[model samples]
Target: MTGLAIAFLILSITIVWGGLVASILFLRSRPEPAEYPPGGVDDHREDIGPAERDT
Candidate 1:
């Protein structure tokens, strides 16, 4: 491949792999929250919001 083509290929590879590595390291250091706030998917609170008023 031409020198310019090779350079662009390396640059693209570095960007993709670098981002992957950074994310892995970040998640490893600070994992996802085990417990989320209330009003999530399983929340059944009636006062959380208004009923089907269509406002």
Candidate 2:
């Protein structure tokens, strides 16, 4: 019974730590959100203004 309890404790700890590590890695890999102002442009473009372009 003692051996079984030790094994169960180790397994549960491993699972919990593994999930925590995976969640950290997953969230680290995602891009952050950038909200637009009210009634602002709802587009996803990297267009530079013609005059603002470096000659």
Candidate 3:
């Protein structure tokens, strides 16, 4: 095998392996779940008044 071919092969393998490892780590991580109470929408906009009608 030529030197250039060997070098290209090694570079490709390293890049592919690194990408696989990163994907696995990202998939393993978990995010916290959000909680919402009943009547959540009402609680959010209760203080805002209705829009005024145009003359």
Arranged by lDDT with the best first, the candidates are 1, 3, 2
Top-TM-score structure, candidate number: 1
State the lDDT of candidate 3 residue by residue for 1-55, as single tens digits: 9999999999999999999988888777844335557756546877777789998
* CA lDDT of each prediction against the hidden true structure: 0.86, 0.78, 0.80
Error of 2 at 30 (Å): 1.1
Q: What's the TM-score of every candidate structure? A: 0.62, 0.53, 0.50
Tens digit of per-residue lDDT, candidate 1, span 1-55: 9999999999999999999999999999889667668866556675667567665
Q: Across residues 1-55, which tens digit of lDDT does each residue of candidate 2 receive?
A: 7999999999999999999999999888875547777545665554644355566
Off by over 4 Å in 3: 31-55
- Report the lDDT of model 3 for residue 33: 31
- Candidate 2 stretches with Cα past 4 Å from truth are 33-55
Query: What is the Cα-based lDDT of residue 28 in candidate 3?
Result: 75
How does residue 53 of candidate 2 score in lDDT? 50
